[model samples]
Target: MPCDFLPAQRALLDATEHLIYTGGIHATGVDAIVRKSGIARKTLYRHYPTKEALVEAALRRRDDRWMAWFIAATSGYTDPRARLLSCFDALREWFASDGFHGCAFLNAAGEIGPATHPIRAVSRLHKRRLFEYVCTLTRETGLAQPDEIAEEFLVLIDGAISLALVFGDTHGADAAARSAQRLLRHIPVSS
Candidate 1:
């Protein structure tokens, strides 16, 4: 069923995200977005002056959705260490889901080559925010170098996602989570 409750701009962004994820960003044009969104060309143009703008908006929406899902998935664990490992559990679920087309940020980065591209910037921001969240979890474990450990954890997370995408298997998350558990072993949990 169509989500008529969403605002027109949000509806457009959601449609664009679906199209861009299923189809390549370059392959999904404004006309396609219009047809998918069921919105008029004038309205789409008025809301987003250019395709790049629409792509950025779609990415931002994706970033919000992804983060919220991640946080919620990881929130059930009471232990800080378990919470940290839950990141991978979340990835496993996401990978096995219906629309598992790899990381949207990575896809956008590839599609928009320039480092300075607005979509690339959104992708980078999403990654940095994820790193920050990991850092928060690391700090809770009383790790001496939360920043450095968080950086390493981020690499594991991204690597797992990439591998899962490449090999068409969710075991990457398990491998990454195992590595994460080893890394957390030395650190003392805060009382």
Candidate 2:
């Protein structure tokens, strides 16, 4: 039997992720990915069965890549404050990248309207983890009200993303990072 896992299959998924994230899920059709990946239509269908499944796989891959980056970002800083700043640093880097298209989770969430949508679930989980990570960092910083700080931080990040997308500038992300750095610096180091 042929190997269940194939490099071509991975290439298709990777290509789908790039197209979907850079563009929008709805905007980039299955044919677009198949063409971009140079994979036969049959091969893609054989692996994914449907476009939605392929989209979900692409979304999952993006999430995994992002989570890996998050983990690595926190690893270099021992101080929770520095670690928290790293969050904004990462966001800034992401926003500043050449193909910078806003957040993948945000885009996918916009595409998949229903709460029950697989893409929605993936997007929700990604945002939840970011929020929870901030909360954990806030708690670690021993802030008097970590929960409140985490909430405020999340708002800042989300707002920054929106403004960035609206204005087609990375300034919003820069401002958010500055604000996060200023705000997080004040949290007491305890927990």
Candidate 3:
């Protein structure tokens, strides 16, 4: 959903996203969100009836923000191939950003137990959107198997994020970019 949040509601979501991103979803509570937001408990609940609902909204907001930033980061290059490879450049910047804990969707999905949970569903949707965007880029490059190349690229993207989080390896994205270049070299371009 587009963030058409009221001032108070936006505050609540900003606080929720920060706390959850830095501290994990299960560990962060409504009380902390209320306090951090400086919005009264009643107001928080008024905006989001349940804690889960607030989390969902916050994750949605994060998804919108992350995707916009990512698209902007990669969209500058005119060449489809450069634009595709710029994905890793974007990741490198994100991995180095302050309070970068890893992919928000992955973190939220990990904390939630049920496969059918709304939070997990949101996570899946975020990944699906990202993958679809990659597909568009690969197809634009005239790759013979754009879908297959997209799948490999998405794996590299996820692997870079995971390795960066686990090892504090700032160069993970660079390595992923190199691997992507190698993958592109092997894949036959369409006539």
Best candidate (score: TM-score): 3
Which residue pairs does candidate 3 place in steric collision? none
Q: What C-alpha lDDT values do all the predictions have?
A: 0.87, 0.81, 0.93
Off by over 4 Å in 2: 1-5, 181-191
Model 1 compared with the native: what TM-score? Answer: 0.92
lDDT of each residue in 72-96, candidate 1, tens digit only: 8988988877888899999999888
TM-score of each: 0.92, 0.86, 0.97
Model 2 agreement with the true structure over 108-170: per-residue lDDT tens digits: 888887999888998888888888878888787777888889889888888887887777777
- Winner of 1 and 2 under TM-score: 1
Q: Ranking under TM-score, best-scoring first?
A: 3, 1, 2
TM-score, structure 3 vs. true: 0.97
Instruction: Tell me which of candidates 1 and 2 scores higher on lDDT.
Output: 1
Instruction: Give the alpha carbon lDDT tens digit for every residue of 24-69 in model 3.
Output: 9999988899899999999988889999999999998899889889
Ranking of predictions according to lDDT: 3, 1, 2
Report residue 186 deviation for candidate 2 (angstroms): 7.1
Per-residue lDDT of 47 in model 2: 91
